[model samples]
Target: MLSRAARPALRAGAAASSRAAAPAATFATLREIEGRLKSIRNIEKITKTMKIVASTKLNRAQRAMTESRSYGETSNKVYQSAETKPLEGEGKKKLVVVCSSDKGLCGGVHSGLARFIRRRAATEGDNFDLVILGEKAKAQLSRTHAKNIVLNFSGVGKDVPTFTEAQSIVDQIVQLQGDYSEVEILYNKFINATSYEPTIIEGFSEEAFANSPNFAAFEVEEGVLPNLREYTLANSLYWALAEGHACEISARRNAMDNASKNAGEMISKYQILFNRTRQAVITGELVEIITGATASADM
Candidate 1:
């Protein structure tokens, strides 16, 4: 019922009013985007920091692993050259010493060992007792292999493991009364900076070492056999611990690096969305203002 000149004014005013409601919804969306952006930024920071820490530790761990490997191999050469083997049919159970770490965020380092033990248990039966070196493995293995755990040491692998620590652990293990035919030191073997696998270093019992087909060739002293056995056990344990620590650090660095990249990607997406939303809000406000001005002019 309005005249031609007033009709344009009324239409413009109605259009402006309709658009006025849009800012509220847009504001809510903007807030959510901002909140998400902040969270992603925080996550990126944390992951970056973790990556740095792991990188710092990786160098020292690798060095220690190298030294330990040399020492362990040297110590075991006598048994290897003597053609020693674990005595079977001796009516004794096997002992598996699991070397892992107390910490986590290392991407399957601990879980891999747990899975290996579980698979062994499933296929070979639970005839072995577990000596866990880390809480992470203990927690994972304890669910099913609780009764088989003989000794557990926590707070291990916090740093480069020393020979003294390994010797102390050996002292405790020797104190255990179980009659084990074979003592296997299970640990993560570092194949490279990026890959590792669970492996075992065999610890020959004193009887197995002495009864070797070629042991008589070495001319070892009468009382030196026991000392050699215990010394070799400690050396093997140190090697396993050092290698496992290196693998864990490498794995953690890779994991944190991936996490930081992913977080950065998320942050970029949210930032783009936030900027576009803000521009849209500004455009919307400008449109409302222009429309209102046009309506007044028409009136």
Candidate 2:
């Protein structure tokens, strides 16, 4: 029922629509694949850089932690021995020093430490106070344990945590002991480059100070024990800092490695899709070209 002229126009319209749809479909496919590739590439770069930075920091942190462990062990032994002779002080309250990292992007290092603190608090009742190191810890603990937090220290990084910094924190803890009964440290201990374990260390109140068998070996002059006590506090803080740093580096390294691997897989999948889309576009063009040549030759 259609006129000849109208039939040609309709066929032409259909051809145009088909041609347009072909390229649009191909273009859309290519664009989607390309976008994913770009995103994956960006993620890859970030993860690679993070891995390198973590590796560098890991070495230094490990060395510092290793060097400090001897001091930590010796101090613990000394403290155990010193528990024999009772000294003068008053009251019994418990203080906890929790160490974490200032920054995130590592996995659950901060959350794990916070969980440990929460569990301990639940078990220990409401009598304990907290001295938190790191912004991450503050943020994590603020939700539920904010009231127990007595102080927060932030901005500790890859640089060797200074003796002065440790001393100041220790001084604050000692001051708190005058009001409280006891002091304890909760932190991640560096077991290896890949592993860190949370641990708790306890310090005695002034009244509970005693001379034990280990203390019996070293005869100290008057006023020396007080100086040694300060040293012990500082040393413990230093060890905690080193161990926390090591744990941060380890977590970061693992996170980055996983990110990089995922990025690589995404890039591969996108590359395959892009190649298939381009091939489809080429095939469509070749079919149109061959059909046109046959018509021209017949004419």
lDDT of 2 by residue, 95-189 (tens): 78888867888888888889998787788666668889888989989998888888878776547666677888787766653365556778887
Model 2: worst 10 consecutive residues (lDDT sum): 84-93
Pairs that collide, model 2: 81-212, 85-210, 85-211, 89-207, 92-181, 93-181
Instruction: Give the C-alpha miss distance for residue 65 in model 1, angstroms.
Output: 1.3
TM-score of each: 0.88, 0.85
Among these predicted structures, which one has the highest lDDT? 1
TM-score of 2: 0.85
Model 1 per-residue lDDT tens digits across residues 123-215: 989999999999999999999999999999998988899999999999999888888898999999999989999998999888888899998
- RMSD (Cα, Å) of model 2: 3.5
Off by over 4 Å in 2: 84-92, 210-226, 287-299
